[model samples]
Target: MLRTLSIRDVVLIDRLDLTFGIGLGVFTGETGAGKSILLDSLGLALGARAEARLVRGGAAQAVVSAEFDLPQEHSVLDMLAEHGIAVGRDEPLVLRRVLAGDGRSRGYINDQAVSVSLLRRIGDELVEIHGQFDNQRLLNTSVHRVLLDAYGGHGDLLAAVGAAHRDWRAAVDARKRAVDALEEARRDEEFLRHALGELDDIAPEPGEESELSRQRQGMMNGEKLLEAMNQAAKDLGQGRGVERMLRDAVRALEPMVEKTEGALKAVLEPLELAQENISEALLQLERASQRVDLDPNHLEQLEERLFALRALARKHNVTVDDLAVLRETIAARLAEVDDGDAGVRKLTHAQAAARKAYEDAAAALSAARVAAADTLSHAVMAELAPLRLGAARFSVIVAGGGDADAWGEGGWDRIAFEVATNPGAPPGPLGKIASGGELSRFMLALKVVLSKADPVPTLIFDEVDSGIGGAAAAAVGQRLARMADEVQVLVVTHSPQVAARGENHWRVSKSAAPEGVRTRVEELSRADRQEEIARMLAGERVTDEARAAADSLLQGTES
Candidate 1:
């Protein structure tokens, strides 16, 4: 609900502050008494396009501010949260806009500066301003489906449909990916087969390559190594070698021991130890020579296997040890190719299941909407005739079947509001067939029917009672009052009946200032309200008859 509106230097509404309440608040004045300045200033504050001409002549800028009392769960708070704007529930939301004299505009939400577009989006959630040719979301045919769904309490069903649609799309995407992979594998089938065949023929083992390399290095120089070992063994042996010479020395030392005491004995012992060490060295050389196999055929076989492993490694761009692992990977991919059709079939089944889920949810929502259309149409029609549109017929048209391609989160429904303003005229779209006054009244009726479902906290009608009077004006006033019971309502009206319906009444009047003309609005007391309504009825004069009529209208509002 709008708490207050402050206007400064906006056309003739300089320094005007107005407070609004829960019920109907009306602003009434004569034909050129600056009645529209109220709405224009409010519009500027609500993120409407700025006009430089709105600035007062001597002022550099114009400012309009509106304060609204928002509930904790209001969607406006959610929208602000999305934009990272924090608000305390105890504080009212304030929207302020400034129109500079040079035509640049600035916007603020609770003193936090925001872009014009963002301000407009937030404003859209806070208030809805309806004029005769209003192109607001309510009148747009595209949003009618949402309005109908909200009114019918189909939120859960709509959510289900949206989730199911996402699942279906995901299933389809998964199937497409599987099919593409299978096709790619088939294209490379021959190459994989040949590579696997080559690996199988050679039968490469994990550590076999390193072992072969070692064997090859040994065999390549086996003959020369064995010859050197044989010579060493012969020289170290006992008979005609170093061991025999040590033995002869030991015998000579033993004879000397008899003559020269301990010195000769020590020399003989060292010579004996030398002979034993030489024999052990000869034994080791013999064992090594026995282990060397100097066959040419063996050498050739080792070289051949080593070269094959190296070649395969080069071809696959891998080390020799990695070839075995690569072979396993290729084999797995070949097996997958063999199973491709089955995988595709599985995914196709999943896709079908998901589509069924979506269809079920969408069908339920569609049926509910079909029922809601009739009910909503009737409710709106009940309001039309009283607002001077008795000849107008309202309808809710739901179009679309369960076509997969045209599916949306709102289900497969295209809803539109159509009307016929003349008795026998064919009904067309609400915006197309209705004249300015007819459209406004139609919107008013629709609003009255959908007020509970609408999230907008404030509804402003800019002379919606444009071309109608008498009972029609009173009916418009009555509906506005009814709507205000659910939400705040502000109307700029000229009709005395509408003026009398205001829970809070304010009068707009213009006077010549020293510099120029200025507009002012005053909250009317009971006596002042009577005189104003009398002026509305009697033109330039308020006679006893006009006063009596105004009193009657005010008394009717009380009853």
Candidate 2:
């Protein structure tokens, strides 16, 4: 519900503040007294188009602010959440707009800057303004289906349709992904097979490269060892053998030892020790030469295997350690290619099943909507006669049988509320068929029928009682009062009967200010309300009979 509206420098409303309440509230004044100015200000705050002329002459800017109290489950809260705006549980939704004299404008929600389009979107969900010239909310074809569903109480069916649509879309996506994968794999099938064959032939094992290298080094060292042993043997065998030379020296030393006593004996002992050590060294060298491996063929085989592994690793752009894992990966790709057809077939079947489910759900919803549309059309017709539109015909058209492209979560029916003002005329869109006054009444009739189902918290009807009087005016007032029981209602009315029906009343009057003409609104007291209604009934002059009639109307409403 709207809590308050504040206007500054907007048209004739130089400065004004109004507080609104529950049930029906009426604004009554003579023509050109600025009742429209109040609505214009409200519209600006509700994100209506901004124009330079709307700003008061000589004013730098025009400002309008509207504050509303919403229920916890209001859809506006969800929209705000989606936009990353946080609102406290009890925080009121405040919308404000500023129009500069140059035609530039800015919009704000809860004091945070926002785009005008976004503000308008949020406004559409909160308040709906219905006037002869305004084609909003109910007149919009896009909301017709939603309104119908709400009226029909089709929450469960709508949920089913939504779920089925999501499932079908998911299945479709899964099938497309599988098909894409299969195509890509087919393009690379030849390369994958060839690489797998090479990997199988070579059969490179983890750590095999290091093992081969170790073995190759050992073989090369053995060859060098054999060469060194042969060189040592040649040196020893040159001239006399080392053992024979040592024996001759020792014999010669033994004879001299007898003559030279102990000194000669020391020399002979050392020569004897050297002769024995030389004989042992020759024997050990021969044994070591036999132990050394001189197989050049084995070394070459190790080099070839190691080099093959290294070259293959380079070709695949992987380290030698990863060659075994690469082989497994390639083999997996080949397996997928072989099984691709089966995968695609399975997904295609799933998609078909999902599509069937969605179609069934949508068909059921369409059936429900068709039945509800007939019932609703009759109900609206029942209301038309009371509002002086007896010859006019109203209808709820639920067009179905559209193609898949026309299907949506809301089901596959196109809903529209159409009307024909004359008996022989063909029915057309609500906005195009009805005149300004007739359109307002048509909307009122629709609102009365769908009052409980309408989600907007506030409804404003501008001159809804236009072109009617007596019983018809009374009927319009009673319906507005009835609708107000379900939602807040404000009416700009010239009918005394409608004004008398208001639980709250305000009188708008234009006055000559120092700067020029200015409009002001005054909330009426019980006595003041009767006087205002009398003024409405008497026009420029109030009469004793008009006051008496006004008092009786108030008493009738109270009763």
Best by lDDT: 2
**lDDT score of residue 2 within candidate 2:** 96
TM-score of 2: 0.84
| Each prediction's number of clashing residue pairs | 0, 0
| Model 1 bad stretches (over 4 Å) | 198-328
Q: For each candidate, give its TM-score against the true structure.
A: 0.82, 0.84
Which pairs of residues have clashing backbones in candidate 1? none
Whole-model lDDT, model 1: 0.88
The regions of model 2 sitting more than 4 angstroms off are 206-323
For residues 1-559, could you state the per-residue lDDT of candidate 2 as single tens digits? 9999999999988888888999999999989999988888888988888889999998999999999999788899999998888889899999999999999999999989999999999988888998878766888899899899999999999999999999999999999998898888789999989989989999999999889887788788996888898899889878987888888888777777767767877677778888888888889999999977668887888899889899999999999989999999988878878998999999999999999999999999999999999999999999999899999999999999778977888889999999999999999999999999999999999999898898999999999999999999999999999999999999999999899999999999999989998898999998998888898888888999989999999999989
TM-score for predicted model 1 compared with the true structure: 0.82
- By summed lDDT, the worst window of 10 consecutive residues in model 1 runs over 232-241
Model 2, residue 433: C-alpha shift (Å)? 1.8
